[model samples]
Target: MAVITHDSAVRRQLRSGLICAVVSATSFGLSGPLARGLMNAGWSSASVVAVRVLVAAAVLVPIAAAQLRGDWNLLRRNASLITAYGLVAVSGTQLAYFNAVAHMEVGVALLIEYTAPIAVVGWLWLRHSQRPTVTTVVGAALGITGLILVIDLRSGLTTSWVGIAWALAAMIGAAAYFVLSAHGDGSLPGTVLAAGGLLTGGLVLLAAGAIGIVPLHATTNPVVFQDFTIAWWPPVLVLGTVTAALAYVSGIAATRLLGSRLASFTALLEVLAALTFAWTLLGEAPRPIQLLGGALILIGVIVVRRGELATPDAPDRA
Candidate 1:
């Protein structure tokens, strides 16, 4: 009876984690399209991400405070982790991705950033001595092949080198997020982590802007979405509420429940979601070749998940 109860509990947690993961992915997938809408209307990448983080922080910090219940020591213990997450995972990733969307199509840029799983495999081998298997290598190859197709070298159009570089940076940031968001070692509560990170990221971005390190240029020009122009704040509002606040909190919660490895595997769905949103929101229809490449990337991600199952770094879902 005890074993059955344990199994039932595990299953329930798994189901909840999956639901959270899906919510996070779909919400995150909307970010690029919405930010692109703003960028098209003269909003700088830094500005878009800054406002997004700041607004999300405003909404989440109170909830996080309640969750803390005045346990100041918990924050002191996890200060560095939260700060790092805020800078790299939240601000840096969003800034870079917004810049990528400014230069290239949303789907293409997101697909490039989605290659972070391959980078994680390499990181583990070098940093943790977790040598990857043949399966991972094959997956990496497929991913690279798909990336080439996604780049569409045969199209003869001048590809944006800057966009690709920015997307690669976002990929690194995402890899950092996957590594840092694990719930092992009794880290900060998921709500606290997400909220604190957003606050830190927002402040850092604002400081950088104040000092002229990053541009804060923005326009009040209406943003064009699909076939109509709408007030700018509406999409920006959604960017904060749905994408950053809801997505980050749920993603961290899912990671805590599902473990980083499985959580990241679930996050592969973001690529599909991004493509779908881009197609529907921005009319950025993906080419057939790009769709094929996307399939390859998904398959490669699946292969990476298979490799993760046997690796020591993937902690058991707790």
Candidate 2:
């Protein structure tokens, strides 16, 4: 009876963790197409990101406030980490990704950003002086190879060297986000952390826009207003509420449960999921190679998940 009870509890936690991961991935998956839609509608990448973060923060602030009242003192203690989480993890990931997409194909940009898991593994190994097991190396290699094949980066190359540099910069920011967000101390709640991060990021972006550091020219563009319609607002709302805010909250929860390194690796599935969604929602049909690459990526993730058992007591690498 006792053994059965323990097994059941373990199973429940696993189920909850998996659900959190999937939800987080699905929400993130929505961002690519949605952002593309906004961009096509004439919004600059920076504008879109800035608005998304600020609006999402506004919505989440009330919720986070309610939960964080009694634990207000905790917030002060983890102030630095939370700020880092917001400025780096939440804002960094979104802004870098948006900037990358502006300069390169969405798929290619994602391939670079999603390499954060590999970065995470490297960070852990260097920080702790621990060698990666074969499982980790193989999983990381397979995921990267599969992502490149799926994104079909070879055909997209042009002489646009500046764009390429921006995309690489985005990759660095994305990697930083994954590493910072994986810090899982039981301080502030995930929603609070997300809300704080969004607020910080939005302020930074807004400040840059104010100083002409990040361009905000869409406001003066006549082309942007001629086609404005109420149809867009609903989708934008969903993007902010469900995809950005809720996704960040749940993703943080999953990170807390599964730990960062593993969670980061598992989240790579968002790339494949986004590809599929883009195909279905935006009519961006994927090529045959992409399908095969997606399959390989799935296989690699599975292999890594199974490998977790081999290091049952290992601390979370990220």
Candidate 3:
């Protein structure tokens, strides 16, 4: 009876985690089309990201404080983790990715950054002595292959050495995001982590913009969607509340439940979600090959999940 109850609990966690992971990926994916619209309207990428982060922080901080309930020790205990998450996982990754985009094909740069999952797999193997099962390795390979096809790298543009370096740096930061989110005690709620990281990262981005380290530019001009022009603030608000705040909180929650390995693999769905949104919002229809790639990504994630379940004792520790 005890064993049956434990199994039921595990199943519940898996179901909840899957839902959170899907929500997180879908929310994160929505950013692509909207952000592109803003950029086309003369807002710098940094400016868009800054607004997204700052607004999310403003909205989340109050909730985080409420969750803390005057227990300041939680904040003090996780001070370094919050700083590192803000610096590396949030702002630094975006900065490096922007630099890489300046130098290489955006698809290629994204592919590199997404390689962070592979890095997480390696980290677990080396640091936690959790060697990936053969099935996991195969799943990762399939996932990478699917990404290459989805991103259509066969016709990719030239990439400079500097671009590769920046992308690699982004990859490291992306890995940190998964590792940091998954490696934690029960004391820190996902909202608290999300809030702290957003606040710290938003301030860093604002500082960088002030010094011109990252160009800051935004016009009050109305932005256009596929059908009509809308006020800028509406989309910005959606980006903050849905994509930035909700996405991060759900992502951290998913990582805690599913651990970094499975959670990171599942995040590959974000690419498919982005493609779907682009098709809907920008009329950028996906090719047949991209559809196949999306299917492969789905299959790969399933395989990875099965592998994790098979090896129940696999250390997902960071």
Instruction: Give per-residue CA lDDT, model 1, range 85-140, as digits (tens).
Output: 99999878877886787787765776678777666666656766667777767766
Error of 3 at 160 (Å): 0.9
- Sort order, TM-score high to low: 3, 2, 1
**lDDT, model 1:** 0.79
Instruction: Name the runs in model 2 displaced over 4 angstroms.
Output: 1-12, 94-108, 156-168, 217-230
What TM-score against the true fold does each predicted structure earn?
0.81, 0.86, 0.97
Highest-TM-score candidate: 3
Model 3 residue 297 CA deviation (Å) reads 0.5
Model 3: lDDT to the true structure: 0.91
Q: What residue pairs clash in candidate 2, if any at all?
A: 86-197
169-254 per-residue lDDT for model 3 (tens digits): 99999889999998676689889999999989989998998988899999988888787788888889999999999999999999
Give, for candidate 2, the lowest lDDT window spanning 10 residues.
220-229
What is candidate 3's CA lDDT for residue 234? 87
The per-residue C-alpha lDDT of model 2 at residue 171 equals 66
Best by lDDT: 3
Residue 287, model 1, lDDT: 87
Question: Could you report the Cα RMSD, in angstroms, for every candidate shown?
Answer: 3.9, 3.7, 1.1
